[model samples]
Target: MKTLKCPLCGNELTSIFRMTKTGSLKNKYGCLICGWETFELRKNENLAWKDAKEFISKFPPIMRSHQGDNLKLDFEDDVLTLIGKDTSRGKLYLQNCDGDVEIATPEDVEQWPWELEQKGGSNDI
Candidate 1:
């Protein structure tokens, strides 16, 4: 079986069983780290597998670790710029023409456009 990951946070997932009120077991894949639960069940294993695959294909890999106060990123075009950082609060300040915005960490910047440019082709974002 292929491994599944949480669609929202990109964390590892585990298969689990829960008892419904009807006293039947329903199998689901859940992410312990982010508390994401899949609604699809093993009762329809094929459909559940398809849904899981579709979910995983939608998100970027979660490569963000706690960089603490040391996180830094520099891009040449000023498309994204770091304006402030508060490691104690786990917040980062960024600014672009869209205006200033706060983020949880540097990894939150997925840079989808830059990635597409690097690949020399369009990709699903």
Candidate 2:
């Protein structure tokens, strides 16, 4: 994978597939530190992206992992917000998920974005 550095803050950039209001998925590159991002609009051909609020509601409001960790799910500005029950764990912001955010889908939800996973994690949720 290629490394993406933020030109403004020298921080690593994160890439995610964001659903546009026009019903398209765009590959977005953004910096958690400086809030710098690139506006990239692309056409989604295969996956039928759903609304953030609607998709999140499919799962239970609270989810528990096999390791006994718990997270509360919420939606904001088309992003999936995962708030850890433990205060020290920090929040995880997700742009996409597999199926529903439930116990059965723990494996998929654990697979966070590559860049964020590398640098510990981001609390910019």
Candidate 3:
């Protein structure tokens, strides 16, 4: 059998299989270096290879963080922002005067509880 190589990083690819809750088998192809993944249910090796090849050709490569990487945080006044790595999205946190906290997105910040906003706390970090 020919070894599969990751399209984005040229690293050797690995195959993983799992049993679904419905008792069906699921097959996945993954790259440890680039964190690329594709799923298919073909039982035949040839079909699985075809699906993997198609997915690799069509899927975009995404940056991934290595193990043990630390994420940076930004604080502005009363708001805090968490910087995400790889394909993760950043998150914003809002804190109130009574020490209560709530998570919100940038677009939803304005719609957050008026009292929280009045506390002069905003996080775009």
Inter-residue clash pairs, candidate 1: none
Q: What are the Cα lDDT values of the candidates? A: 0.52, 0.38, 0.47
- Top candidate on TM-score is 1
Top lDDT model: 1
Ranking by TM-score: 1, 3, 2
- TM per model? 0.41, 0.31, 0.38
Question: For residue 55, what is the lDDT in candidate 1?
Answer: 65
At residue 11, candidate 3 shows an lDDT of 73
Candidate 2 Cα misplacement greater than 4 A, ranges: 43-125
Error of 2 at 92 (Å): 36
Clashes of each: 0, 0, 2
Q: State which candidate, 2 or 3, has the greater lDDT.
A: 3
TM-score (C-alpha, index-matched) for candidate 3: 0.38
Q: What tens digits encode model 3's per-residue C-alpha lDDT throughout 1-125?
A: 44455766657677767688888876777788888766666655566666766665453322221122122223333433223223345344444445555554443433222113332333211
Estimate, for each residue in 9-67, the C-alpha lDDT of model 2 and write its tens digit. Answer: 44666665777788766765567888865554335311212222122224332221112
State the local distance difference test value for candidate 3. Answer: 0.47
Whole-model alpha-carbon lDDT for candidate 1: 0.52
